[model samples]
Target: MNDHCNRCVGCTVQECRHHSDCEDFCTLDRVQIGTHEGNVTMDQCTDCKSFDRR
Candidate 1:
């Protein structure tokens, strides 16, 4: 992920895909194979278009 998005405090990338409502563009469910707690795979964030390094 980029520094901008990563530095954004309280910015959960999951919210971008609206995982609470939809799962179509959500990469979380695909990579996350363990507990639904902290088992989220961050690779999804790197591929996110919203991730701005600037």
Candidate 2:
């Protein structure tokens, strides 16, 4: 959790290093989105490539 907040990016993932503890947003200006499945199917298959474990 952090004190910084990037209003454009709404995030609820507390495990991420970019996630803000005071607000439901990210601290990064930009985020990378990716998929883990061989064939993109559902939303669960998607992932935040910019995520860094806290």
Candidate 3:
């Protein structure tokens, strides 16, 4: 993807397929965010449902 195409979607997970190859960002137009907990109260409860292993 072009620099601008995914630059706005900041990320740090190196294992995600959508993560930029050369930058700390995601290459998807939109990302799916979800939770694994019934009653979430911490950041760890959230997840990037859009994630796909590289």
TM agreement with the true structure for every prediction: 0.16, 0.86, 0.84
How many residue pairs in model 3 have overlapping backbones?
A: 0
Tell me how far the alpha carbon of residue 9 in candidate 2 is from the true structure, in angstroms, after superposition: 1.1
Q: Please identify model 1 stretches exceeding 4 Å from their true place.
A: 1-13, 17-20, 26-47, 51-54
- Sort every candidate by lDDT, greatest first: 2, 3, 1
* RMSD value for candidate 2: 1.3
lDDT of 3 by residue, 1-54 (tens): 425337667899989778877889888999989999999999999999999987
Clashing pairs in 1: none
lDDT of 1 by residue, 1-54 (tens): 322222222334454542323322332323322333355566543444443232
lDDT tens digits by residue: candidate 2, 1-54 = 378889989989988888999989999989999998999989899999999998
User: lDDT of all the models against the reference?
Assistant: 0.35, 0.90, 0.84
Q: Could you say which candidate leads in TM-score?
A: 2
What is the Å distance of residue 36 in model 2 from its true position?
A: 0.7
Candidate 2 — what's its lDDT? 0.90
Worst 10 residues of 1 by lDDT: 1-10
